[model samples]
Target: MGLSFDYALLNLGRRPTRTVLTAVSSALVAALLVCTAAFVRGLEQSFTGAAQPDVALLLSRVAEGDVLRSSVQAGLGALVRANVPGVAVVSEEVHLACNVTVPGSDGARAAMVRGVTPAAYQVHDAVTLTEGTLPGPGEVLVGRLLARQMRVDPSRLAVGETLVLEGAKHRVSGHFAAPGTAIEAEMWTPLEALRGIARRPDASVVFARLEPGADARALQLFVDRRLDLELSLLTSEQYYADLARYLAPIRALAMAMAALIAGAAFLGGVNTAAAAVQDRIRELATLRALGFSTGALWRSLAQEAVLLGSFGALLGLAAARLFLDGGAVRLAMGAFTLGVDGPALALATVATLALALLGTLPALLRLHRLPIAAALAED
Candidate 1:
């Protein structure tokens, strides 16, 4: 006959301190796994979600992944408009992915600055002005989430405030909102004014909007035919996808670190289980004398390990939801919120159960060789 479920639970209660410590260790490992997965998944979703299929990004061939390093002639937007068919709008902008010191901050922080023309509003229709108006020379507009990205109060970045960038003072003229896009972490200024500040004679990129029924392949072919431009074209979706691919190594590193921690926890659990089995040898021998089979005892021990692991897994999931949910992690591109979704929780649970089973193997093997006579003779 199999060991009773109630008896298996009783075995865990006999050593409360050891059981609790082992469970806590498992919980820590599970939480780490969940947080790492959530962080990477959130970043991927943020980048992929920001892409608009109807827009094409034009960059220098050498700056395919890093827009800040890209520089093309300022007149490229005009040239594309004149040469490419099915082009609805041309939004030319200068991108500066630089570090700036905010007022009351201790050190320099990374920020994205865009030098844009009035036509920029036409192409990026998702951007809506929330306050004030379009910026003129020496003036700038801030994204609604820029304050959050800088880890500052929103009131500090209010309209009429001054933002010092590269030793140049730019007055905040307005605030804009671009929901579900990476632009939410950026600041905008007049093309001529930012060009002077950046000391660049060219724009970093051109964003072209396609008309209805227009395809990006035709635009690519058009750019390919223009040998003089030295330009590369990608759909906005493809651009962000490439950025996600470039940052994949960071995600892999996070997962690898988590796995190492989990492996240590698994070893700890194995030791804890072995000790518990040793301490219970006499009791198990008494049960064997009472007609319980060896298989029944082994099954009971496995159940106890699973029970302990499940408790730890529940605690870890709760901790992840309370702490990691809604937490924002910033990367080189922008910031994305950590998501403790259903899939993350499920993965943590499965990993916890697998660790529990693996941890019991050594104890099970020991039980196979345990002589009922020897165990019963112990003090």
Candidate 2:
């Protein structure tokens, strides 16, 4: 008869300490894998999710695609709507970074701020005013992740609190959230109010939303025909895609860390498997003498490994769900929450089991050629 799973379970029970140790190691590795996947997934979502197919941008021809340094006439939005055929709405917007001070706070914190008219809400459809009304004159709407993004306390930007910007105090109107998009880290204000405060007479960029199935070429053609306007066009997809590439190094670093963690886990599994094999040399030989094949003993060892890994991976998943799931992390690109979703869990499980199986390789390699006669004669 072949070795059954019951035999494997019995072997594990005999070495309580060894089984617990290996299982614990597997759990730690699994938990870390979840964290890595969450970070990389969250970063990609923030960029890609912000890109909308129907939207495009107007920028100064000399500024390339960078909006921060771009400037155009203040009324470009209305001009585009009146001139372009396929355009449905055009929003005049200004994006800038400035220092904001909360009352009773020690120092000013720098944050990204956007100035926009009501049309901006339609162009950036991802944003939802979850907590408060749209911003009015001398008022600001903070994003849900603003506290983490700015590395400031959440209480500092609470509704009804006043924030000082450019020596002018503006009340926080409410909070908004755009899940999986970077806009959740920014604060928005009324277009005229912010323009007055910053003393900027021109719009930094024009955001245009084209009608469904609208020819995007109309936007390009409009800008192309008016070389005198010194304006260029870029799709929202193209801009956000470039931003994703610019941040690739961070993802690469996270994968590198994962590789290192995998290496450690593999080595640990191999060591545990080797020790168990060595300790059971005589018993394994006894089984061989009892008409059990070398293959059966090897399979029995693999089954034992699978059991330990499954238990450990499950424990790790539980701990991660409790502690790390939905947690937020800050980066230079603002903040993003951990994505402990199905894919991450699947990846962690597969990695753990695969490593467990591979860990049996060295010991299983020597099993077939084992000197059953000599092993059985041992004291």
Candidate 3:
């Protein structure tokens, strides 16, 4: 409707190829930002959701005692129960990784094995024993995903099926699913059962639940005062966040890669926009000679750039969605599904607009310094 709109259309019509290329470049950058941001957010949510708000975890300073280790003193569990008031129960955790051969497949895959108390089910609702009964000592409960990979019907993985863990036999007593969480990739066994396999009397970590009205900081202080045990207390929420730190290096690397890719795309898009603008110099000069204001010309150029960016963005987003929806990607320490959330989509849209705006920068600067007489004479 406006003079600027008309001018933009004229320029684009004169150099359709360059305009399209600029748009494509913008779209790619936008898509990468959207996807990377979504990945970081998803990982954060997954880890935080894995732990409960009120629960606390106790670990030795010696091993950086978290779920990753194999040993903590068996007597220490009793000491925490005696000293920490309003403390519910202390559950020992043992972690192991082993290879299992899937039925009908000669290949083997590694899986995580966790040992926890029966109270773990109550302390952490995210962990649900979906079918069959909890594992007795020398028995184990596996996650649904692992069950599927194992090619064993979870319901049919009865108490007597021999499950080999590091060449030792344990019965498959149960199956569980911690939906949308990393725990789904693991199997559970009793704390005592893991002692021998762990080759130590100490469990990996002690998970504690504070009583209602108990001060978390106070409990932590009390535990801190006991210098002999070398223990540290972390609330469940903080614990998971801390654990996520391990993945930070990889996430940062992904972001850096995305940035590099996006930067290349932006540079390419800018070059395209510059080429497109150069081709339309004669037409733009004609408009100015015919009394089109500088502002009008500028707006028109910006609009054209924006359109290209927007179209590119939409195309890129469509590509990402089609390829990533429900697709699984491996992450540091775990794997996650690609989720196309509202924020990610919005980021993509913004990227498209930004690309267009950036593309117009050089053209606007050039136009400001251009000689009207020279521009007109070129035509």
Best by TM-score: 2
Q: Candidates' lDDT values, in order? A: 0.83, 0.88, 0.70
lDDT of 1 by residue, 48-130 (tens): 76687899989988886568888889989998899889999999999997566667666667788899999999888678999
| Better by TM-score, candidate 3 or 1 | 1
What CA root-mean-square deviation does each model show from the true structure? 3.3, 1.6, 4.0
What is the Cα root-mean-square deviation between model 1 and the actual structure? 3.3
- Candidate 3, residue 215: the lDDT equals 58
lDDT (C-alpha) at residue 46 in model 1 = 69
Per-candidate TM-score against the hidden true structure: 0.84, 0.96, 0.82
Worst 10 residues of 1 by lDDT: 328-337
lDDT of 2 by residue, 239-276 (tens): 88988887899999999999999998888888888888
lDDT of 1: 0.83
Pitting candidate 2 against candidate 3, the one with the higher lDDT is 2
Pairs of residues at least 3 apart in sequence or in different chains that clash in candidate 2: none
| Model 3, global lDDT | 0.70
User: Cα lDDT for residue 346, model 1?
Assistant: 88
TM-score of 3: 0.82
